[model samples]
Target: MNERQRARRPGGRSARVGAEVHQAVTDLISERGYGNFTVGEVAARAGVADSSIYRRWGSLANLLTDVALTRLNARSPMPDTGSLAGDLRTYAANVAREITGPDGLAVVRLAVALSSMGQQGVQARDDLLAERTRQLQSMLDRARERGEHAPDAFAVLDHIMAPMYIRVLLGIGPLTPEYVDGLVDRLL
Candidate 1:
């Protein structure tokens, strides 16, 4: 195979390179907001040639979109505790813990900021929200199948997640277990 073909091969090194690039993207965004960095900086941080990133991600916005998608995909799988209340509580607790962490909060903040820019941001935001919505809906659907009188998935999801996002974005009160319990109770 030619050098270009070898370079494009996916394997351990490619996976490592992708992970490093993603980590660098998150760290850079955390250190210096989303709008202030360049692909060259990310390339340097990832210890890869700038052309590698360009070849892989195409552009800065595309790279950021991939970062957002990767962040969302890395979250723990949705819980299944046999009961809607139990599931909601578990999900809320997990989300609360994540949103309060430095890396998680940085990803969330950057995704939100990027959503306002243009097409790439909008696509990333949509993909992220869609995945989240799908997970919540799946949990609610399982509850419905198990004879629980669940409300509309989207409405229930809004009630549960909106407050969490508010806290994450606005620096509101802590996401205590009591708070999650209250939200779950109110939803159910």
Candidate 2:
């Protein structure tokens, strides 16, 4: 197989059992919702000793964090559309498509449900939000550099792009090309 596949069963003393355990937990989460899950169950599912999981992740929350973020936090490389509207629409559609998928929906649901109690929760949410905002901001900055957008247009940028999440969460509309075209027309 490839290098990533090879890494699946790393050959050394420090090879991670965490990887296998996390995959098992991911499968279980797909089978069973996060709320109705347990560490013992994950251990059983992973076929690894419970201590191995605890040793790697320290707690269920940590394990779930790794499972959720590691799987869903892969941001694709941004495309250079040569114009603000084209780039933003492409980016938004790409992100919406990715995040609205089965795994992405699962991660969002899990994050919303659990990321609120402690330091880890706050950090996790902050990290996600910051990453998202940074992506949008980078696109906006690039657009400005190419003279496709106004230099001081953060407000307009937010106004146009903020609805992406609303569409996903409220299920108010499809993220269709026609819809993206409309958004581009209004914002750009």
Using TM-score, give the best candidate's number. 1
Q: On residues 1-188, what C-alpha lDDT tens digit does candidate 1 reach at each position?
A: 86556655787887889889999998898789887898999999999999999887767877887787666656756899999888888887887888777665665566667776688767766766687678778888999899998867677658877788778788987888998889879878
Clashing pairs in 1: none
Residue-level lDDT for 167 in candidate 2:
70
**TM-scores for candidates 1 onward, in order:** 0.80, 0.64
- Please, what are the lDDT tens digits per residue for candidate 2 over residues 1-188? 65445444655632556666878877887787775677788999877777766666656776777666565445544567888767766766676677566654665677765564477556655665566557667777887777664433455446555566667777766778777677667765
Q: Specify the poorest-scoring 10-residue window by lDDT in model 2.
A: 148-157
